[model samples]
Target chain A: MQTKRMTFSSRWLPYALLAPQVLITVVFFIWPASQALWQSMLRQDAFGLRTTFVWFRNFERLFDNPLYLASMKTTAIFAISTTLLAMSLSLLFAVMVNRMLRSREWYTTFLVWPYAVAPAIAGVLWWFMFNTSVGIVPYMLEGFGYDWNHRLDGNDAMILVVLAAAWKQISYNFLFFLAGLQSIPQSLLEAAAIDGAGRTKRFWTIVFPLLSPTTFFLMVVNVVYAMFDTFGVIHATTEGGPAQATNILVYNVFRDGFVNGNLGASAAQSVVLMGIVVVLTVVQFRFIERRVNY
Target chain B: MVENDRFGSLLAHLILILGVAAVVFPVYVAVIASTHAPGTFLQGVMPLLPGSHAIENYRTVIFEGRAQAGAPPIGLMLWNSFVMAMMIAVGKIAISLLSAFAIVYFRFRFRIFFFWVIFLTLMLPVEVRIVPTYAVVANLGLLNSYAGLSIPLIASATATFLFRQFFMTVPEEMLEAARVDGAGPMKFFKDILLPLSITNIAAMFVIMFIYGWNQYLWPLLVTNDERYYTVVMGIQRMVTGGDSEPLWHLVMATVVMAALPPILVILFMQRLFVKGLVETEK
Candidate 1:
């Protein structure tokens, strides 16, 4: 909310500057969002002949529907697991890289470039690696007396999607974690070490507590990411498949709207998605405001 | 206690090395697969070593495409992705720069109002309102056009905030000096503010370009025509081709090519990319 101390006394120019951004926001973001809100209340027949305004009917049906509940459950599991996997791995690497003296740049570069791989492409790479028949991972798994077939097994499909989603996300989490690790003062660790605390003890007592804010931020982001952004991963690899095992809410909305032609239901789902994003955004900004003090 | 312990250093190195290998393993597999004969994948486990088909597979995919899947040539798709990324990066930066400048320097009425309106975009991502956004684009007849591919994505609240934050840190004397020299606002911005922001702009460009290039669902939804297909979404078509197992060699080749540009951007401008990413979030 801060502005310049010295001001430019321009009247018409400010309006001209803001016009294009305002125009795009209204048309592309605000307009569509309001449309989704309105359409969620109206249902049209298959023939597009009869339309009825049934307020909250789509939402009611969605909650009552088993598949929607399952999708929500799947999203929860996927989000939590992806966050844990991506964050923990990144933190491990970040901590280790933090300890290095010479090879930090090389290791960081190797880990970070994966951030550039598109979610769908990352999914394809992982999918090919776990592709029951020809996949290297599955072949390796089978050697351990365990069968790995994402094609038919729902659990396997979920695991595959999670792995792919986590793979794509690791670089992002790694960067943040690396930055977080680098920002931690060495004096604190030295202080702890001089106090007779071991390396592991220093991490748990000092390093982790200091890194909490970064960890919390990454958690929210990774959850939002697993919920929305991983649509590409699911679509490209599993298609939320093997019996809706990996069906997340965003994918369901796309399916309901385009593939199923249930526009009203899809609009309702979009509204629900909007509500979630609003809540998440609120959490993020509020946390950031508090973080300023910390 | 302050000793430089060799055992601890060795352990750290080993973990980092293993971590690096795990990160690179999948892409390594993809690269190796891209090099193999199409017939190799049909026989059991994918071959571990690079084969002799790398040139042929990349050539076929880039020039010819897999017609059966209705995917366009990789050369064309790559061009579309590049154009889309460039337009999005430039357009977002331009609009955001102007808007941020207005909000920061000028004491206009509804300045706070305009700031909140722009910030409204930060809450709702495109995915949350996909159906209606699609309808908006379709109504404007933007489907299958380059404009459709890029324009809907160019409005960026993040860039506006980033520039606004950076501009606030600029010393007020620069502006007072510019005005004392009889330079108009536009001239001052071009002369003083613009050059000052070159590094910030470059950093933003790297981040936004990757974001633009990696867009999968938007391009998938808006463009049905093969002529407009981006390589990221186009990969889905190549992999899901019919039934008889995707031609792994070319498919992996397509994957490599589709991911190459953004990967190259990150590798080259990593410092800028990391700076943009962290600062924008902050």
Candidate 2:
């Protein structure tokens, strides 16, 4: 908050430094975002190449489309299930690693390895493991005479996608949670133990509350990631196929825009997705900001 | 601590070991699978040890022309990915460093507004902007060009935000001393700031490189021709272009080869990766 009076030369310096970034952001980021907004309100003309202003007609059509409606539902389910699963597994793993006095580094390194793999590759790996013919798990299941079809069943596909996402994300959340866990003072835990509180009570009363801020932060990140960044997995694994069982909002946007060339519809879907993310983020911050203590 | 406390500690270790195994087993399987022959891999036999066929698989993916025989050349795809990743990495780091330095070191009007604008971009994922982004790329006539893939992603708000945060923690005395020594802004940054920020820069570079390398949808959408495909894009083409049985061996082989660079980087600089994440969280 300290004001440093700047000479004319120095005053222009920061702007000069910011010139490249501003230019790129405007040309790429801001321009694209605005273009998407503009496309959402327009309708394609007879040639399919020309466009006319429709003024919310695309949004209306989106509402009427059953596939779009189903995708919205699928997105919510995917986001919530993946977020919850990733958060819980991350916390459990973080706690396990934090409690270890020896071999902690090895455990920590092993935990973070999954985060390095590309999402596309992760999807491919999971696809192989879940494939009915070549997959080891499916082979073993069939050996026992049980039928399994992840690609065909909607619920099974959702679970598989969520599991794939949660597996990749656990490392990212675990790193943050482990850092948070280490930062908590040990004397408090020692005092809790000296008071004869059992491990569960001590954890609930002392550790859990102390770790709430990290949990809340990870929750916001994990949810956003589940919603937006899981597109690669969904695209590679399902292609939103088997009756669009795995078509989340982002994947739907990709399919509609590039695959189907319904630019207007895709833009409308994107705006809707952006609105949902913004609202969820705002609600999360409002709820958690008050509870987070420095 | 009591004997019961020691017992609880042992139990915690047991749990941690099991968790580590769960996290690592899949990767282990993938690595072992990479070394097995095509028939063995397809049959789903357990290869508990590394086979002698890793070189064969690598040769098949990289030079033997087995991964995607008729698609874009594998060598060309690797070159494309490497060049694109390097360009984006350099561009992201330079822009981020400059913007961060401007925000943190220099006095500027509308600083907070600029900061917020950059930070807000982080929330808007690429999916939300892909339609317009595709339009912009098409408009620029950059479609299928390396510039088209690299330029849009170069201005990373996340990198700028991170560098700004890191820059703010540097002591003011260092800057004042550099100024007193008759160094200009550029000179001060080159001599003082850049050297001191090596670790942070390296961390950001690795992260941005991985990000650029791993990008799928943007490249897939923006580039129509197979010639411009990155490694991930190439892998996707392999998976989808076939009507015959899914070539698990070739697919996994390509995957393992694609994953090699990042995995090696992670192995050597594992500490830096952990530190970067911790710093970001703070």
Best by DockQ: 1
* Clashing residue pairs found in predicted model 2: none
lDDT of 1 by residue, B1-282 (tens): 365788998898898888888889999999999999888988999988999989988898999885543467889999999999999999999999999999998888888988998999987888889999999999999999999999989999999999999999999999889889999889988999999999999999999999999999999999988888999999999889677788888889999998999999999998999999899999
Global lDDT for candidate 1?
Answer: 0.91
The DockQ values of the predictions, listed in order, are 0.83, 0.56
Overall lDDT per candidate, in order of appearance: 0.91, 0.79
Q: Mind giving the per-residue lDDT tens digits that candidate 1 earns over A197-283?
A: 988898899999999999999999999999989889999999988899999999999999999989999999999998998899999
For model 2, report DockQ.
0.56
What TM-score goes with each of the models?
A: 0.99, 0.93
Give model 2's clash tally. Answer: 0
TM-score, candidate 1, first chain = 0.98
Report lDDT (Cα) of residue A113, candidate 1: 92
Which candidate has the top score in lDDT? 1
